[model samples]
Target: MNIKLLAVGKTDNESLQKLIDEYIKRLGFYINFNLEILPDIKNAKNLSEAQQKEKEGELILKKIQSADVLILLDEKGKQYTSEEFSGYLQKKMNSGAKQLVFVIGGPYGFSDEVYKKSSGKISLSKMTFSHQMVRLFFVEQLYRGFTILRNEPYHHR
Candidate 1:
C-alpha cells in the first residue's frame, strides 16, 4: 500500500529539512511514501483557534481519497510501541489497501469533521511537539518501522 504523510505548512529549518529528507529517502525503499505539505494559512491572526482548525480540517479532508485509510497523529490518541506500530502497518498492507494516509494537523489540532473521517490515531509521544518538528519525528519513526520490518541494521543504529 502507498503511504502518504500530509502535514500543514513546510519545514523551514535547513538542518531539520536535511534530516527529514534523509528519512524520506530511506522510507522510499520500503514503500511508496510521499510527504505532502499543505501551505500554511496567512494572516491567521483573525481566525479563532477553532476556526483555524475547521479551515485546516477542510484542507486535510480534501487530500483524502474515498478508499484511503486515514490516520491522524494526535496527542490524545492511542500510543503504540514500535513493534505494535510495525504490525499495524503490516496489517494495513496485508488488507490490500490502495493507500494509507497519515496527517499532522495544524497548531490548534483537528476539527470534529477530521476526527470523524479518520480510521485511527497514533500518538508519537504524550508530550507536545511543534507541528513542524512532528513531521521530522514522524518520518524518522516511519523509517525505523520499515527498517524493523525488513530486519535491517538501521533500526538498531
Candidate 2:
C-alpha cells in the first residue's frame, strides 16, 4: 500500500529538513511513500483561528481521494506502542488499503469537518510539538514501525 503524509506548511529548518528527508528516503525502500506539503494560507494573520481551520480543512479534504484512508496526527488520537503500531500497519497492508494518508494539521489544529472525514487518528505523544517538528517525528516513527515489521534491530523493547 502507498503511504502519504500530508502536512500544512513547509519545514523551514535545514537541519529538520535533512532528518525528514532521510526518513522519507528510508521509507521508500519499504513502501510507496510520498510527502505532500500543502502551502500555508496567506493572510492568515487576519483570519480567526476558526476561520483558518475551516479554510485549511477545505484544502485538506480536497487532497483526499475517495478510497484513501485518512488519519490525522492528533493529540487526542489513539496512542500505540511501537510493536502495536507495527501491527496496525500490518493490518492496513493486509486489508489492501490503496493509500494511507496521515495528516498533520495547521497551527490551530483541525476543523470539525476534517475530524468527521478522517478514518482514525494516531497520537505521537501527549505533549505538543511544533508542526514542523511533528513531521520529522512522525516519519521516524513510521520508519521504526516498518523496521519492526521486518524484524530489524532498529526498535528496542
* Model 2 Cα RMSD, 1 decimal: 1.0
For residue 80, what is the lDDT in candidate 2? 95
Clashes of each: 0, 0
Candidate 2, residues 1-157, lDDT tens digits: the string is 9999999999899999999999999999999999999999999999999999999999999999999999999999999998899999999999888999999999999999999999999999999999999999999999999999999998874
| Candidate 2: 10-residue stretch with minimal lDDT | 148-157
TM-score per prediction, in order, is 0.97, 0.97
Off by over 4 Å in 1: none
- The candidate scoring highest on lDDT is 2
Q: Candidate 1, residues 89-154: lDDT per residue as tens digits?
A: 889999999999999999888999999999999999999999879999999888888888888888
Error of 2 at 1 (Å): 0.5
lDDT of prediction 2:
0.95
Pick the TM-score winner. 2
- In model 1, state the lDDT of residue 112: 100
